[model samples]
Target: MNQSMFIVWRESVEALLVIGILQAWISQQSQSHRLSKFLWSGVLLGLLLSGLLALLIMFAGDAMSGALNEWFQAGMALIASLLMVQMVGWMHRHGRSLKQDLQRHADQHLARRGGLGLMLLALLAVSREGSETVVFLYGAGARLRGPELGLFAVGGLLGLVLSALTIVLLHSSRRFISWRRFFALSEAVLLMLGAALLVSASERIGGQLLAMNLPEWVYGSVGDALWDSSHWLNDSHGIGGFLAGFAGYRATPSALTLAVWLGYWLLIAGWLRQRREEPLPCLG
Candidate 1:
């Protein structure tokens, strides 16, 4: 539920930001009213397409069983993790100029094809964010069922509401929290979430491999726990469980899990260092 909520909140905020930028630019144009209509039409169409994608994923999951299902779930988790990392890196590189770039594209589209071009731009932008949200939610909540699934849905709705409120607050008063601060905090959380997803994918893959006729040493390394830490903080329940879900904390991790976790952070660290060396644009 928590994962679904965060994924929705983060992605919705980004989608809303894109719409806000386009709308703001439209308001400055001569045919503001007409352009606004086209923009909204595009947003609605994008949302509809995203809904279709969600349904498609749900049906596909329902159709699969046993090993195929496991493999599919693992693949989705891996894709989601990679997408999160890519999203964070892309945002870090382009966030400062996002507003300007959106406006520039809007101008070009309007000049080339008028309202139709603007509509297409909005459609593509919103659909990209929306499609990502669907995939992320499915990857995060694929194992949930019954009441847990209901809670997941509720969490997603809550996230959407919270995102709207957040946008309002940020636009109204940056004295409390600036856009830079918001993105920075969210980026940190996203990296942790990515780590958790990667761990999940690794565990699933490791389970499958361990079940195969592998050598004793390979089985020991892949399946055996290095050390037990449940006495300190059990990862199956309470706060520890939350940490496991949100940050990849494992009380009884195998060698594979540890390796994946460590590698993820190391890559992130190197990426951040490289980003820091490049001059950043002003976030005005």
Candidate 2:
């Protein structure tokens, strides 16, 4: 429920940011009255498309029940992790140019394609975030059941409400809160959540591989019990469970899982390092 809430809040906040920027730009125009109609239409259409995607995910999950579902789930987890990584990176890359880019897009559509183009722009922006939210929620909550699922839905609703409030604050007065700091915190949390998904994916794969009766060496090397910290910190209950849910904190991790976990962080760090060293492209 916590992860679901966070995912919804983060994704909704991002969508709101884009919509807010476009709406604000439109408001500044001399003839924005008609454009407002297009903008609202686009947002509604985007939301409709997003609802379609959610239904698709639901139906697909319902269709697959056994091994196929496991594989599908594993794939979704990996995809979610990759998406989270890319999302944070994308925000960083476009953060500086986002406002300018949005305005330019609005100008292009308004001049060339009129209302339809602007509508399309808004549609794509909102739909992208909306679809991402669906996938993230699905990936995070695939294993949950019963009343927990109810709480998951509740969390999402709360997140939406919170994001609405947040957008208002950002648009009006953000003196008490810094957007940069907020995103920095988000990036950190996302990385941890992404790692958790990766770990879950690894477990799925390992379970399948074990079932296949593969070479003993592979299991010995990868599946060998690394340590037993369950006594000190049980991953199935209490604080350990929360960490496990948030950051893939396994109390008794196998060697392979540990390697995969460590490797994920190292690779992400290297990517960030390389990205920092690369020269920025000239937008002029």
Candidate 3:
């Protein structure tokens, strides 16, 4: 439930930011009334695209059975996880320039070609954010059902409402909340969520592998837990459960699960190092 809420909250803030940027630009223009309709239209269309994606994912999940379903879910989670990393990394590296870029695009579109250009710009921005939300939610939705599903829905709506409020507050008083730190924290939380999803994908994939009647050693490595800590820190209830949901905690994790979880961080560290070493375009 918390995972769903966080996912929705983070994604909502991002989507709202894009809409806010476009709307703010439109407000500054002379013929604001004319362009407002197109901006709203683009938003609705982007939302529709997201809705269709959600429906497609749900139907596709229902259509599959047995190992196929497991594999498909695993694939979706893995893709979502990768995309999360890309999203966070991209923002971390470019958040400083995002406002400028958006404003420049708005200027270009408003200057050269008018309504249609703005509409398309809005469409692409909203659609990109919406698509990311869909992927993130779908990955989280894999484990939810019944009343929990209701909570997920409620959580999503709440996230949207709360994120809008947050945006308003942040924009109204940027000094109170350091924008850089806010983004840095958001990115950190998002990366943690991504790692959780990666671990989850590994779980699903491991289940499929075990179902294939692999060798004894493979089964042992994938199925047998290194240690049991449920007695001390139960992962199904209390604070531990919350942490588990947030960070892919397990009372007794298999060797493969542990390896994958640890390996993901190592891989990310290496990638960050590589990115830092690369030369950047000269400002001069």
State each model's CA lDDT, in order.
Answer: 0.90, 0.86, 0.82
Write candidate 2's Cα lDDT for 66-159 as tens digits: 7888888888888999999999888778765777898999999999999999999999999999999988888888888999899999999999
Return the candidate ranking by lDDT, descending: 1, 2, 3
Tens digits of lDDT, candidate 3, 1-284: 67777878888887888788788878998999999988888888888888888899989999999888988999999998999899977775667677778879988987788887788788888888888888888887787789988988888888888888878877888667655666767777877888889989999988878887678999998989999999999889997787677777888999998998899889988886877754332111
Sliding window of 10 residues with minimal summed lDDT for model 1: 275-284
RMSD in order of candidates: 1.4, 2.8, 3.1
Q: TM-scores of the models, in the given order?
A: 0.96, 0.93, 0.93
Clashing pairs in 1: none
User: Which should have the higher lDDT, number 1 or number 2?
Assistant: 1
Model 1 Cα shift for residue 263 (angstroms):
0.9
